[model samples]
Target chain A: MTVVATDETGRATPVVSGYGPSFAEQQPPRNERRSPRRLPRGLRIALGAILPLLLLAAWQVATAFVPAYRLPSPASVVLAGVDLAQRGLLGVHVGISVQRVLLGFAIGAAVGLVLGALIGLSRWADVLLSPTISAFRAVPSLAWVPLIVLYIGLQENGKVAIIAIGALFPVFTTVAGALRHVDRHLVEAGRAFGLRGVSLLAQVQLPAVVPAVVSGLRLALAQSWLFLVAAELLGSSMGLGFLLTDSQYNGRLDRLFLTIILLAVFGKATDAVLGVGERALLKRWT
Target chain B: MTSTTALPVSFRGVGRAFGTARVLRDVDLDVAAGEIVAILGPSGCGKSTLLRSVSGLDAPSEGAVSIAGTAVGPVDQRCAVAFQEPRLLPWRSVEANVALGLPHGTAKEPGRRRVAELLELTGLADAARRRPREISGGMAQRASLARALAREPGVLVLDEPFGALDALTRLRMQDLLLDVHAAVPTTVILVTHDVDEALVLADHVVLLGTDGDLPGATVRRVVRVPGARPRDRGAPELVDLRAELLAGLGVPAHHTAPSTAQLSHQETA
Candidate 1:
């Protein structure tokens, strides 16, 4: 029986030809698209470039039919970007937006993790804080602009605060839920051996919830970017949001398209970085 | 170390209840130092609850449980438990999981050596560097046993440790368990539902059954297996004993002729 099974999978080249390729040949080849692991570095890069190239081609074709003033060509957007780069305003705006995102994300995630632990670990904290947070979360990110600007007098603090507020809820909810629902058997096993309170939490509970928390952090990061525009809308002198508004006020379709594209690239880049870090950290456990 | 000193365990009038339901009632048993005892019963008979109380993971609501004359508290360092699931940390390698069984402040060199010794004893030395996810089910279970024995605790409590394995693996694990017992000689409290397993591994077999009057399951009887280490599975004495245990479990065991291990299935059918 074992010999027949082996022959069917391994050496029976023609007997099961109607069933498609033998199991050995069915194994993915080095450069097959589905088996990207063994693909050469240049081919992998070309594969990644295909979708953006197609999208750019479609946009360029669309621009020819649309009114030039209403929708600028991709080449016009590139020219506008070059024009901004000559004046150095593009670098300053991009740097400022990145700075705001970093500041807001760090503060929001730290507080979210602490608050999540507080509510998750204690019934009293959950009862005292969760209702107010839920209520606050119901208000839109745009709605917070006036209140934050009024409180902080329309400075970087107000902008950063709105982003932080936007980032908090997802991180808080994910971490709290994950920590609350950790595997009880793992805890029992930890304690059954010599693990005590803090040690048990450090060795078992914290590691178990880390994957969930990292995912929450990723969601919070995307939220921070979404609120970046609304955050800077509350009176700002510099940033991608300010540049976007300035380009719209002057009716520079090319500049507006360029700024939007820049935001997309920035958001995608940051998310990819976070994903890499998460994969590295979770590699040992999952 | 304290683990080298085998500890006697005693339960006196122990009873436990959860909210309105009582799960164990007036349960009492005494296990001598270094003896192997198996608790056998049908489902919902509170066999697991009794083992949990012994490990101090759960408290008996009515009476006290003592280990070597000391009352069990919230955590009993003298006992190490290997639950049914391997329960190894996916993050840690097999050797590291076993090292967790060592006392927290154990010196680095001694702890490493002890973990290595346990890995060797459990036949997991080759797989020590592998994480829990990378090993087979039987290998993972063996690693769990290695962890439980890492601290050299006086009492080793296992809650159906081999219940999750395939038949061949389970038999191999059972034999490996006996080999481990011969080498270490710690008092073992094995909770199981398989009659043949209890007979093969234990010095004494306990049956827990619930009565209408009692709030929880109580010990029905204790049968002492009359043989030495590495006992014969096909012995006539064990055949009768298996029949007797089957009868106690309410399975009709009228087979007086030479019986095989399939007696339970035949009787139930």
Candidate 2:
């Protein structure tokens, strides 16, 4: 409450709030200032399909000009693909492959996540099981093919088990890493907010690990495809992989090429689905 | 300790040491019903430790911490805490994030209703559809505050809630907090390093500083804040009180004299 009379005009100077003038906060960084973006309605869908269309066009052009024996053109592949489809061979093959992958992938992911969580959650668990997991990771997916068939045989169960073993480790490792790496500050904050016990894990801890889990699932999906193909190659009466092997043995280059194209399309299609699911679930997150 | 019924919370002779580093020693605090007590101290002075003790995140090495007539151990719905950062579940929508504090389905209907009411109170109703990442820091923090409020608890603990915000936003938040205090009047314990923030927001400003011999520092003085809600900073007594707090905060003597430019700027803005 001091009023000093030290002004040049011999008037009193009033003491006021020390806080400086609040200017119109300057416009923020240009990139930070960008307006929200949206793809024009239906444009996203159209744009997504464009690359495939172009690729298919190029494949058709190549096949039309080149020898059937070398490239076997898109038209011939489609004809082969359709011919295989009508004979119930394609459907049966696709069904067996899909079944093998889904069955193996589901079991593997479940076991992997639970086991990984146990290891991640406890130092003792990590000490005991961590080495075992790392050792198994070094063993290639195909290496399990002979052992799995020897133990479980050429039955569906055997193939499924092999795929599961192949897919499981990556999912497990990633989930563990995700859970381990999730910010501890967040967990502590959850504790402070009166969320203890089961609620704490469900509300706070579990969520922190989800993005990583989704990423793991994406990887596992890829492994499932790889495992399926490998399993079918080792021994299978059906599946695209079996058909591919069967066609190559018979010198049906067109059918073999057709299966490769089918495999690529299917792999991409599955990846697209996973990407969509991930986006939908994570939209609210960040 | 004998008059425990009058105070909702009390920390008695509490002390904590981690490894060789002692964070707090022989500290005691009491929060009566419907009062705002702010702890102001430098970083690492153990104000946060004390706050954590009150919530039972860390147990005291020596004595006891009691909340709502119960001893601290596991956390419960009786007390809610907000940190400087908004610790919202990123997977949830703004509305769902607020609702998560409500017990499972106890939050189902009431949670939805409260989310709306609370969002409106926090001026975040329009952002209900957005994700945590889709919002500004202030808005995300607003959602966090709303989430904490969902439990309708008797005790609210805040650790430098607005410390991360810009000055203008912090000012607005301070006013909003005062308004919230007026409406709900819960017993609030706010921790801050800024002396003016403590003065403006607390009913009692507890100064915790390192001049004490204890590792976590000790509560050296507790100043009783006077007057009603929405106190005018321009009032003569308030000006003096601010000067005293600024002195405590080590504001330079030259800068201690209020700048005339600020007053003129405030008028124009």
Candidate 3:
């Protein structure tokens, strides 16, 4: 039963397992990784890391012996990727492409959410908007490329328009579908609790739709990247897509492989971030 | 009834019908403040619909529903409902789902306390952090109870709340509900097809029978239960009453007798 004096000479309480500042913020000790000598987690991670390394090694071995036109060796392509990244030219193109994708994604997502929610919320809105949206969506993202290029010129607007178009429909369709399935019972429950109109929508329906919307966003993110490459090929000065196209003119297969690998990794990274968010959200309700 | 200012719930001339079928006809029921009333009925009877009307999930086609004399058209925050299925958000932790039922304006610290209190009250204190999928059906229902009680409603409406539990669990829930009701003194309107449950929990018992023409309909008969508080589940009088209700429900007088207290399997199966 001893008290300790701190810097200000104020009395300090003794720390005990369940009786200290830590006690105030107590949580169950997390289950230990539980491998006196190690098991599932280490094995899983090792397996994950090893597969990619093995693939790269195999690809490099094949490329070293194979002719240059078809496939570049893994080491050379990685080196080329590093060289492109360091040159500042690759960064400029990557930066502009990223900016266009993000800006377009934001705009498309915003518009999609509003329209999707509106249609999802009401039969009248659904009736008015569904057919037109379906028709527009049926026309592929690439088909809009020519039209947008003609109207806005194949530059910033065209690339952005392409990404926006690519990102929009998935989000829109997902939101609409999610809205449709967003638990009729919960909405009625909200209304019963004196929540009406917009309050009901905001409080119950919107949160319910989030997981589905997140799924759509994940799809849209992947699609926008694919569409970005296609748009860049038409008339963008720089981008991962532009890099690929420009490399093809001189048949620099190494740079093409590098950009393609970057796209795959970048798309996977977006999916990973999305997976994190989805897990977090699912954790909230379940 | 209007003169009884203390009464928290009052139903007047409440009649409901769909197309040509009548569910409730000129129904009049009143729940005194802190009183618990159980609505007992047969299958296809509108016991659920009646409870839904009280919950504002379904509006009575005739007459009106009022809370402290305020006519209710839609569900209000003043009452909380627990369904048979534990219709939870499925994405929220037990605690967060419980917290969601809280009225928006409540301050955080006290609201958190209330959520904790409800969790503890429902015997779900340890499972608050668990997800619905991670818990047993009993625990999920317990969380559902916590969610309903978190609102601190003037009226607590339950529709076969324990009709899904195992026999032992259902008995435990019945007792738990009785204890909680004693503590909170909120007007509880429990709808069930279990006459034993109605007798044990209700200060007043309402017997409901089906209307022949109505495919999805019901009508209720109010039966006042008189005896000491916490009526014994094993008592002879309760057994007789339950049997009478069964007869009223069109079960043959000599049918297989069920322990009405263990009513969970009866209704669901």
Query: What order do candidates take by lDDT, descending?
Result: 1, 3, 2
Q: List each candidate's DockQ score.
A: 0.20, 0.18, 0.14
A37-106, model 2: which lDDT tens digit per residue?
A: 9677599899989998999899888877887777777777778889988987888888888888889999
Candidate 3 stretches greater than 4 Å from native? A1-39, A45-66, A82-86, B1-13, B20-22, B30-33, B67-70, B76-78, B90-96, B99-104, B107-116, B126-135, B150-152, B211-220, B253-269
Assess every candidate by TM-score. Answer: 0.89, 0.82, 0.81
| lDDT (CA) per prediction | 0.82, 0.72, 0.74
Q: Is candidate 1 or candidate 2 better by lDDT?
A: 1
Ranking according to DockQ, highest score first: 1, 2, 3
Candidate 2 docks at the CAPRI level of incorrect
Q: What's the CA error at residue A257 for candidate 1, in Å?
A: 0.7
lDDT, candidate 1, B1-269, per-residue tens: 63466799999999989998888888889999999999988777789999999999999989989999999878699898998888998889999999989977899998999998888777778778987766667777888898988878889999999887766567667777887787789999999988888988899999887754656788878889988867777666877888878877767667666544242222111
Question: On residues B86-141, what C-alpha lDDT tens digit does candidate 3 reach at each position?
Answer: 76666667888788778778788888888887777776777777766656666667
After superposition, which runs of candidate 2 have C-alpha atoms over 4 Å from their true positions?
A: A1-68, A122-124, B1-7, B68-70, B102-117, B125-130, B212-214, B249-269
lDDT (tens digit, per residue) of candidate 2 on B168-198: 5566667667766666777888898776677
lDDT by residue (tens digit), candidate 1, A1-286: 1111221221112111232222223122323323645778899899999999999999999988999899999999999999999999999999999999988988888889999988877789999988997887788766877887888866888788888887888899998999889899998999998787789889998999999999999999999998887776545789999988888889998988998999999999999999999988777765
